[model samples]
Target: MSKIGQAISEIQTLENISREDRWVNRLHPLGKLVLTVFYITVTVSFPKYELAGLAGMLLYPLAVFTVADLSFGDALRRLRVVLPLVMIMGILNPFFDREILLTIGRVPISGGVISMLTLMVKAVLTVLAGYLLIATTPMDEICRAMRVIHIPKIFVIVVLLIYRYVTVFLSEARRITQAYELRAPKQRGVHYKVWGSLLGQMLLRSMDRANDIYESMQLRGFDGNFRLGKKAALRPADFLWPVLWALVILALRLFPVVELIGRIFV
Candidate 1:
């Protein structure tokens, strides 16, 4: 498939996953959002040399995947493009921080190496937590959770519209590409000479479509304020999920859980 088509499919797949009738998907969005934020904050708060403590943070995403029956391999695959960039953020750390902090036998490990690994772990855990949240929670529910937290209405509306219309924008681009391909058969890709004209046409088409969408919204009584249906009352599970996870996360953070476990066996 073309790259654009693959992009569209990925978005649809995420939407489908969120809509699945799984227990995790059914949990209240606000609780998931809270836990995700808390998990990320704790993960990033660890000391640069405290790799063992940060290692314990992996439990959160692992539990979610197991409970939700999500494919860990698939998640990693979908995130392949992003993981490299995140990993590279700390590549220079090893060069800048060369203090010897510890040794295994005769071999010495520098502070730079530990900190670099620590940073990479932090990046992976936080990114996975975010992906899990989005994979399980629909965009509407996410925005609703934002509203519950008192996020500005304008910001919420902008987020919702951008997500909702992105597919439309991509679809238009795909149509233009296909038409161009038909006219210029045997070309490997779009010619540089036509790039500007193609983009101009896409912009014009997208603007017209946006105006029509806005008019439709007006006819349907879309005021400046976006409205969601009456909020659902919070359930017991909604309260329990975040509380339970928070305690586990805090215990891991405050104690040397990984090191203690290693002592039991060694």
Candidate 2:
């Protein structure tokens, strides 16, 4: 398939989680947010050269992925965009870090290179954790979680609107590309000359759609904001998941026994 077709297909796949997946989806969104932040914090707390420590961090997300019944391949695919950028940053480290920090034969390693690798792993794990959370939890729940966590009403409203409209923007972009392909006698790379007008037309159409959306909202009595009424009460499982994962992360990072096995295997 063409590049645009591939992109759209991926988007549709990511949007496919349904209410039946509620075991993972039913977790309070705030709980998921807290867990995501906690996981990131623990992963980033280690020294930059601690490859074993960083690799050990993968267990948490892997276990969660299994429990959630989420697709590992799909999550990795979504995360590919960030991974290449991390790899590129890691590749650049050797130039600036000329000091030979370690060696395993004739080959030398630098502090910056080690640090970069650690950073890359940290970034990848954190991003994967985020993707996993979003994959299992709906966007509306996430926004509602933000509200429950005492985020400002304005910020919550803005986030909700953006989440609601992002699909619209993407759909419009795909339509524009399809139209371009249809009218042009031959397919061509996006030319500089047509870009401005093409982009302007997309923006114009987006604004028109936004205006109609605003009108509809007003008719529904939206006065700059809407409230998500509290539905799912916090359950015993909600508290248990975060607390349990927090201890697992702490054990992996702090206990020498866990670290030793992690070093030996990972």
Candidate 3:
């Protein structure tokens, strides 16, 4: 799947993004993790048709994107892989609920339409917020932060392995897909007949590769313990950053700043 390749490349981009020397990259990973949870919680709590309120959620991610000196284009490029799925998820809303709700200027909008837009915005904001954390904060830092917070070792380990190895899984899948495409060049796509055998082969190949990888790790003394760097020192910003994000989120949630600006201009 092209989506698989996109995910693999996305992780590579995240690793590169984490190396940028920026204020966001310097913030304590624990702080970012807490704020990320807060953000998603508040974002999801919004009513299904509250699109204006959801617009405000964008500010936090945009601010982080700027402060981290991250590439918005690269982020959106990866996000494209997700947009179609969200669209499909919400596509039935319009057909199912056709109640007339509000007007944008002279144009009437239906409840279902509003809800669809809300879902899309919510999807984008939540995904971007999570990616912001991933891009700026290294995987090891997140595991260390989880352990610091008394999170279960098994939970942390599972999360760490999933993040680290999903890319490997996708990489294997991509290689298999490429091989299939080359072999079946006369066909538009992999033939339906080959799908099952293709997947089985991919599984066998991936397992063998994974075993080799594990053995290599054992040779290098992986020891099941993910080595984390010295705990990042807490600075004043560590305390201030989460507070600022919370305040901004609350302000945007409680009041439609966008509507207020519209009124001032009107």
Candidate 4:
């Protein structure tokens, strides 16, 4: 399959996973959303050189993966493109700060090296936290949670439409590429000279398709707001879920759990 085809398949797979019957998928979306936001906030709040403290933050993802029956390897593979981009954000940090922060045996680790590693960890943790939320919660539920929190209706609508129609956009692109390949069967890829014209054609076709969709939505009474059925009543577990995770996250942030564990063995 082509790359665009693979991307569409991956997206459909994720949507299927979100709709699966599982305990994690059944959790109130608001609680999971709040916990995800809190997790990312705490993960990024750690001191740049405090890598050991950051180690404890791994627990949240680990617990979620176990309970949700998700594969860390699969998550990593799905996020392959994004992870490298995130990790690269810290690539130049090692050259900027060279002061030695500590020594292990005969080797001295510099502040820049520690900070770079810390940044990479933060990147991975934040990305995985987001992936966990999306993997377990359907987009409609997530949008409902956003509306519950009083997010702007327009913003919510845009997000919902974008998520729903991105596949349409990709499908259009795939068709365009396939047509080009058929016409230029001997060519390996689209010629640079035709890139602009192909993109223009794709954009026009997408806009026409979008307008028809919008008209259909209006006929169906879209009314500028999503009616994602009745909101589920918040259960006791919903209340307890975020509170429990918040306490654990706060504890990890406030204490050097990794260092203390090492000291115990020492």
Error of 3 at 151 (Å): 2.6
Give all candidates' CA lDDT scores: 0.89, 0.79, 0.84, 0.89
Put down candidate 1 lDDT per residue, 170-211, tens digits, no spaces.
887788788889999999888999888889877887789889
Name the regions of candidate 4 deviating beyond 4 angstroms: 185-189
- Residue 126 accuracy (lDDT) in model 3: 86
Report the C-alpha lDDT of model 4 over 1-266, residue by residue, as the tens digit: 99999989989988999999998898999999999999999999999999999999999999989988987886777567766786677777778888999999999999989998998888889888988998999998999999989999999989989999889889988998998899899898889999889898888887898899989998998888778897677778888988999999999998888899999998
Look at candidate 1 and give me any clashing residue pairs. Answer: none
Q: Highest TM-score: give the candidate number.
A: 4
The TM-scores, one per candidate, come to: 0.90, 0.84, 0.80, 0.91
Instruction: Give every collision pair in model 3.
Output: none
- Candidate 4 positional error at 94, Å: 3.2
Lowest-scoring 10 consecutive residues by lDDT in candidate 4?
Answer: 78-87
Question: How does model 3 fare in lDDT?
Answer: 0.84
**Rank list by TM-score:** 4, 1, 2, 3
Query: lDDT tens digits, residues 159-218, model 2?
Result: 888866766677777778877878875867556889899999888888888899889988
Model 1: lDDT of residue 245: 96
Candidate 3: segments with Cα more than 4 A from true spot: 1-5, 104-106, 165-169, 188-224
Give the Å error, residue 51, model 1: 1.1
